[model samples]
Target chain A: MLDPQIIIAGVLNGLLAGGIYVLVAVGLTLIYGVLHIINFAHGSLLMLAMYAVFFLWRLAGLDPYVSLPLVTAGAFAVGFVLYRLVIGRFSHGKDENILLITLGVSIVADNLALLFFGGDTQTIDVPYAGDIIQVGAAFLPLPKVISCGAALLICLVLGLFMTRTDTGKAIRAVARERQGARLVGIDVEHVFAVSYGIGIACLGAAACLLMPTFYVTPQSGYAFVLVAFTIVVLGGMGSFLGAAVGGFLIGITESLGGLFLGEQLGQIGISLIFILILLLKPTGLFGSRA
Target chain B: MRHLALAAALLAAVVYPLLVPNYLATVGMLMFFTAFIGQSWNISGGFAGQTSFGHAAFFGVGAYTSTILQVTYGWNPWLAWPAAMAMGGLVGAGIAVLSFRAGLRGSYFALITLAFAEVFRIAANSASITRGGLGMLIKADQRPINFQFKDQIWIYYLAFALCLVSLLIAWWLTRSRFGARLVAIRENEDAARALGIDVFTEKVKVLALSGAMCAAGGTFYAQKYLYIDPNIAFGIDKSVEMLLVTMVGGAGTIFGPLIGSIALTTINELTRAAASVFPALKNVQPLSLIVYGAMLVLIVARLPDGFASLLGRRRHA
Candidate 1:
């Protein structure tokens, strides 16, 4: 039952899956760091973005990779506007209210997709979808390898944007000290919207990458969102490095857990980790003291 | 004057089922049943301000406990009901101690509860004692002694009575010292502790009470539907439903859950009926949910007191 080759293959597959998970967690951690509220709509928004990718492929002849930039930008705009219009205006300065409001947003967004798109599992068939790449004992799908690489590239770019740019510095300042940022003449609200946009933009890219290998339903958002949240929590809320590393860890857990526990009970590993981390250390691995 | 109004309302409620058709009675039953469960949520979430996202955990425990007791052990379901509540209370207190001892608050608490519920869901799905996704079905013993009624009107009355009981609990919470302590904790836990209140014990107590009520609701639900499954027993849907009714109704107020339940059930039935009628409109089930979701946002933003505030009475929730 414990084949080293099979375990190595599982590890490899988990790493491949982790790339996109990192992208998703990065978005969530960014939002939580800045806003101090869990965005419940994160999953629903991802689902909607996946639908966009699906429609782009179905309506036009655009491949998932080709449409990446478009969807990412569009997602950014959506996030920015959503913050300005709904989340910022209505939260009443309470984190709990924002959580509930986001919960509502997710409900609305999910049902809207159900109403408009119908409940169907959609996937894109890129011509090279079946292509494979071999490494060590593992045989990986070509698309998965490409997505993994692309996802990492996007994360590196995002990290650079966060650390190297003046806007990035200002966003960080706002995250660290909102009042202090305002005192220093930074536009706090603008920084907020920008951060939120950048966060959601990650999801857009994730959606594009995910379309090749994974199927999207109204539920894909929820499925990925929970895993992303686990990654974020495990990594430490708001820690980019944590998100990156935690993503791979969770991906491996899912793969290995399924190997040992069977499909039905395998999912428990993630939930258990989430519960334990929160109970033992709410700050997570990289988060500051709670 | 208030007492007279209350008497008149109770009078109307007593006569309502008799006057209405059996279909309408069932709808009323659903409204009251939801109100009962929603009120249980209101106790901890609304009144005590300890919002949970996994009340379904307790709900499932009650459901499975009663079903197993009746089906496997041959224990009467009526006897199993209180036993289920005991189990729910124990689970509730256990969760409270684990979380509160670690000082989990706000979203942390909410998310932990969700995780716990998920754990239960997975356990139910995998454990053979639960029959592992096959679900359990109650025997069709349609006699009053078995807690299953033939006419369905008795069940309606049972639901209505349950809702009334929950309302009384809410009313007591608003007036009792225990309730006051919970409210103080909600307003400011530090202040409550400063005022010589044991915040931890109070929170645990309220959660136990809320859990017991919720568990009773679960048993009622299992008996009503005559089926219990992992998904049905511990689903996020029930958690969402409990939260939605309380939040959309009035949260802390005595009448909030009842009002919210009626509004929710009405919207649900209306949208489903509309979809059935138009056929061209095809699916309004999502439409109703959309409406509920939008209402949640709007209420959180503009009407924090919910529709209960529109009653033109100045009462503290």
Candidate 2:
């Protein structure tokens, strides 16, 4: 019923949106792959990071790009200390306990944002927000295009860091075989804190990318939590490539779904996909373990 | 001694409503209603060790089903209530079969339930039958047969009665054979399976039961408020609230949800009163929730048994 050109445009739009999702999912999958627990607070933390970006811009007149590194560093420190102080200390190596703790953490974080940030939906006004980039049948916004490119570059750099660095190797080791890593004298606890830090750092980068196009509300974090989990599961938990691909696929689904199914029902596809993946093949694209 | 305590508590509840103002009576109703729903969650998540993150799916389904039947089809509210429970049970069974069949449990199960609730919410948002995002309103008629009441105290009694029924069901679970099997599954699923327990069937059964109970609570809520919307019907907040109460009180204990509800409602009311007094303390609602969040974390970490444990720590622990 639709023109091929229109369809193409929708797909392009979805892919651009999916870039931010990939960055968020990367953090989620890393937490999942290493900690072996679903970080229920991922969205809330991302929300906190978005607030940081908003304040940095609102208070200091700094552009999001300029504040990315500072916000990312701050997020990483918070994540590390949070794990050491509450999560690791309380979890006692139980997956379910960790899940509950994170659920509690997310509740706290979301409400904390509500308490401080108020419930108003805030968006940044970048000068180039209205600028457009034409690709084939699609005309993408400049901010989206920039965010997409930056997201991909960040993922690539993170991949290299994971594959090349000793700490990365140590993190991988811990993820693969925790006891073996411990036997080799890897400070497993330190690695956990670092991995959590890196995961939250990804969220920091994502917050900067998202602020240009998206609005920030206390509820925004809760909205992304499900989408991030869906993408992470779709990509195969802990698989960077899977997360990236899943991000694009989900993006396309969202774009097309909105185009065809209407805005209200378009979100049903994501929830259904999450259920189906969990039911039929939870390992996802690159995962061997469910 | 425990029986005497419960008897005294029951007597106090019956008379306390008579002594309280209308506003306080309404608060009592809310506390009991919350406890009933929380008990519904405790049945699956606590007693059966099947933690669901989307009990709202069942609650919403129940609320919508009864409302649609009564408003659209002209059924009695009493009849619609049972129909709602049946619909809720069917949905619970469907989710359970799909999930448990695929060997999902723990966090995976929790996530899937959340997704199902989302699906229901989005569908409800778009569907014409549900009136879209504008929400559906029940015609207000101050008649007992129609399930509407002119007097607030009567609704309070109804909520109180529902809480009592839920408490009885929980008490039965504490002593019944079905309860023992569910506890086994919660403590260790593989071992229960090894011992010839039909883990799959039992889980589906418990989920269905929990769903029915939650749905009944939903109908009660709709009747009290006379409104149902996509978000109000199938929101994550309701799910979290149910889990919070049960966990804060004591997950597996029969009285856990009741205790948790009392504690939370008291805090909620106190904060509300404080906010009203301060005028400048605009975030009292979220402030109280922050305390709840803190309490949830502390309870999960240091006091897993919840406040219920405080009364009977040696007996249960």
Candidate of highest DockQ: 2
True contacts kept of each: 0.80, 0.77
C-alpha lDDT of all candidate models, in order: 0.90, 0.92
**C-alpha lDDT of candidate 2 relative to the true structure:** 0.92
lDDT digits (tens) for residues B1-317 of candidate 1: 77999999888888889999998999999999999999989999999899888999999999999999999899888999999999999999999999999899887788788889889999999998889899999999999888899999899989989999999999999899999999999889899999999999999999999999999999999999999999999988899889999999998999999999989989988887888898876878788889999999999999987899888456442
In order, the first chain's TM-score in every candidate is: 0.98, 0.98
For residue A40, what is the lDDT in candidate 1?
Answer: 82
- Where model 2 places Cα greater than 4 Å from the true spot, the runs are B314-317
lDDT per residue, candidate 1, A1-290, as tens digits? 59899999988888999998999999999999997869888999999999999999999989999999999999999999999999888876556678789989988998899889999888999999999889977899999999999999999998898899999999899999999999999998899889889889999999999999989887667667678888888989888889999999998999898988999899999999998888898778888857
lDDT of 2 at A27: 95
Q: What digit string (tens of lDDT, one per residue) describes model 2 on residues B81-152? A: 999999999999999999999999888999999999999999999999999888889999989999999998
Flag regions of model 1 displaced more than 4 Å: B312-317
The DockQ of predicted model 2 stands at: 0.84
RMSD of every prediction:
1.6, 1.1
Question: What TM-scores do the predictions have?
Answer: 0.97, 0.99
